[model samples]
Target: MDNRTNLDDYLAGLGISDAEESAPLPPAPDTTAAPLPDAANESPKAVLERFLRGLIARIDPELSVTVRETEEALEAEISGENAARLAGRDGRTLGAIEVIAYTVLAKQEGRGDLRVRVDVGGFRRRQADTLTKLAERLAIGVAKSGEPHELQPMPAAERRVIHIALKEHPDVMSESVGEGAARRLIIRPRHS
Candidate 1:
């Protein structure tokens, strides 16, 4: 009855002094033959999505995540309130998130080849549209003046948009110049 009951006294008091009154031992867990838990069996895509959601929740719990697969990569899009700001000015924050996603994919349990692309509120898509329009406008100017024009150095993704925009053009051709961050595209009147 006291706070610290003696084991022998308690056992005797409970009338459990005989073997039949004692409780049976529970079965031991099967450590070696046990299969993984359901969560551990989740696909790589599911795991990545869960991680992305948790990460974005830190920024704002109201933000929603949508993940899909393309032949080239897993595209994860984040939306809702200040999502563009979350991407940061000129998508610097989004780029960092992308690097983090790729790092996650690299360290995943299975399949090291999967690629991750993190976009915030269609920022990358809109930027691609803007770059494509710029490419088209520049191509027109180059055709008229028969002058070569070089665009300011840009990221490879933006550069690819420019190149593709002018791919079928009659008068201009695009080529990348310089090295590393200094690399840029040159749009010039193609010579026969």
Candidate 2:
């Protein structure tokens, strides 16, 4: 026995009657459109603020981020009880978040040179102050002892703070040594 169903029979079986099948499709949507807004024209700080706020909202719905822009950099200050979690241990998580935020903002603005700094509960400021004091004390020790002192491994940014703190010391000098994660700053007596 042969079993063949015509097109109309198939449609009827599926409840799509001939009238509906014969109806013309809605007119094709208009394809022409104006160009997208120039992302470069938007402020980098604004882009960073939007990105950071969205990220923080995922972690703490009640938290808020405040962004400050300067000629040298953009700073995002996270405020809330849960904000400390973003800082992570030793501020590594905060550093990673800053890297990701700056990267995203740079790509969106078509400029990879944008600098963004992230801080949680004033952690970065306090850390910088601590590093500055340590550098001063170590420089004095090295100068008095006429010997070198090697500091514990630190991130590039922290090391930079130490170097800057001792940049003008008359009796001591600072240099970075070691490779990759093991890199650290060294303070030694000035030869002259």
Candidate 2 residue lDDT tens string, 1-192: 333235335333322223233332222234332222233455787667656754664566667789998897898899788777779998989988888787666656777877888999888989999999999999888988998999889889999999999999899989999999999998988884
Which stretches of candidate 1 lie above 4 Å from their native place?
1-42, 109-112
State how far residue 69 of model 2 sits from its true place (Å). 1.8
Q: How do the predictions measure up, each by TM-score? A: 0.74, 0.75
Global lDDT of each candidate: 0.73, 0.74
* Pairs with backbone N, CA or C atoms under 3 Å apart (clashes), candidate 2: none
RMSD of 2: 15.9
Predicted model with the maximum TM-score: 2
State the displacement of the C-alpha of residue 186, model 1, in Å, after optimal TM-score superposition. Answer: 0.7
CA deviation > 4 Å runs, candidate 2 = 1-40
User: What number of clashing residue pairs does each candidate have, in the order they appear?
Assistant: 0, 0
Count backbone clashes in candidate 1.
Answer: 0
